[model samples]
Target: MAKDLTVKDVLYALEYMRDALVRTPISDGRARWNMRLTGASVKESVANQVRASGSVSGIEDTGTQIIVWRVAA
Candidate 1:
């Protein structure tokens, strides 16, 4: 079953994930933000978030119907 997640929920998840990486010394990082929405909505929301916060560099649509958000260094 797919999970219904709102824009706020997605953003919160991303923030939490980024906070969790604060201790690690990594050059580049990536995090996957999965949403139950359709492909178009997923793409739109991802783009909005990327524009709102420059932290997100890009997004990838996994063949398994999952959206992956690539965090900028």
Candidate 2:
């Protein structure tokens, strides 16, 4: 049976994805990956702890389904 996702779970997932993005070094490969992962606005925005959560949430609404990409941090 399929399992249901909770809002808290989604929030946690977003946090992980955001952290991964933050940890990524600024390089050509990272740039390409960033483009694929995040949007124009996110790339433009500063990658700080405070801003990362907002940025990740903007990309996807974790209210419905949990973003699987973001595993447990």
Candidate 3:
């Protein structure tokens, strides 16, 4: 059976993934916009959690549970 992820694990995974994304800027702006616009719910959820935790960057959630965090300027 697949290992189940706890809430903490999911959060950490999302954060880590967002950090990794920061290192490489996405090439396709349209695709990025589409993804972001389409996944509003996921982004909002991540953003809410990050905000509650006092994180630096703003989170852009995609509704599919995939989070994209903006690196702090």
Candidate 4:
């Protein structure tokens, strides 16, 4: 069964999938504006989480997706 993911879990998953994920900019079409807005909101939410957690090293924006990496202590 699939499990619910916490913010930390999501961060870890992003790190693990970094290499496999790609970000592509949405096309400049009115129909796609909503999707673009939704993506931006999700990115902002992730960014907020990263800022709250010192465990996260940084985030990379691929224009299509965000990747989170852990900080090495």
Candidate 5:
């Protein structure tokens, strides 16, 4: 990863991975992502992406992992 990568950059990465994320199974209306110390900026980018997706009803970020709730099937 390049130094000085901003949330916008991370968000772009997430956008590129949208197909993969969509393929990830969602059980019980939620999808969990284990971020594993990737840092706050990446987590924030994920939250912002989820919000922009307009599919998930809620988002829970623990600064390490993310649990996206109520994802549209």
Candidate 6:
């Protein structure tokens, strides 16, 4: 079954992504990953947190999904 993620779940997932990007690298540095959204509305709030967390460089919202990246980091 599929489940919608809550704000808290998103935050934790972001933390995990941050840790992965910071610690593990695709090759030289963290590039990006396509993160699943709990809902469309979650994008508005989480986008800022992702940027502010500095876990990723930024995100690309395509209405359908958000891609978390750390290319600059």
What would the per-residue lDDT of candidate 4 be over residues 1-73, giving only the tens digit for each residue? Answer: 5443346545555455442112345666212111122232234454456546765443345544433355331
- Candidate 1 has a TM-score of 0.31
Off by over 4 Å in 3: 19-66, 70-73
Decide which is better by TM-score, 4 or 5: 4
The top-ranked prediction according to TM-score is 6
Best candidate, lDDT: 6
Q: Assess each prediction's global lDDT (C-alpha) against the native.
A: 0.38, 0.33, 0.35, 0.40, 0.39, 0.42
Between candidates 1 and 4, name the one with more favorable lDDT. Answer: 4
Model 4: per-residue Cα lDDT at residue 8: 59
- Model 6: residues >4 Å from true position, as ranges? 1-8, 17-40, 59-65, 69-73
Q: Which candidate would rank higher by lDDT, 3 or 4?
A: 4
What TM-score would each prediction reach against the true structure? Answer: 0.31, 0.26, 0.28, 0.32, 0.28, 0.33
Q: Report the candidate with higher lDDT, 4 versus 5.
A: 4
- Between prediction 2 and prediction 5, the one with superior lDDT is 5
* Candidate 5 local lDDT, 1-73, one digit each (tens): 6464454444444444332122122457554442223432333345456556654344334432333333322
TM match of model 3 to true structure: 0.28
| Better candidate by lDDT, 3 or 5 | 5
lDDT tens digits by residue: candidate 2, 21-63: 2233344534211222442223222333323454342233322
Residue 62 of model 6, lDDT score:
41
Model 2: runs farther than 4 Å from truth? 19-56, 59-73
RMSD of each: 11.3, 12.9, 9.7, 7.8, 9.6, 10.8
Looking at candidate 4, what is the lDDT of residue 45? 52
Candidate 5 is scored at a TM of 0.28
For model 6, how does the per-residue alpha-carbon lDDT over 1-73 read when each residue is reduced to its tens digit?
Answer: 5554444555565555432211112465533333443322343444445556754554334422343545523
lDDT for model 5 = 0.39
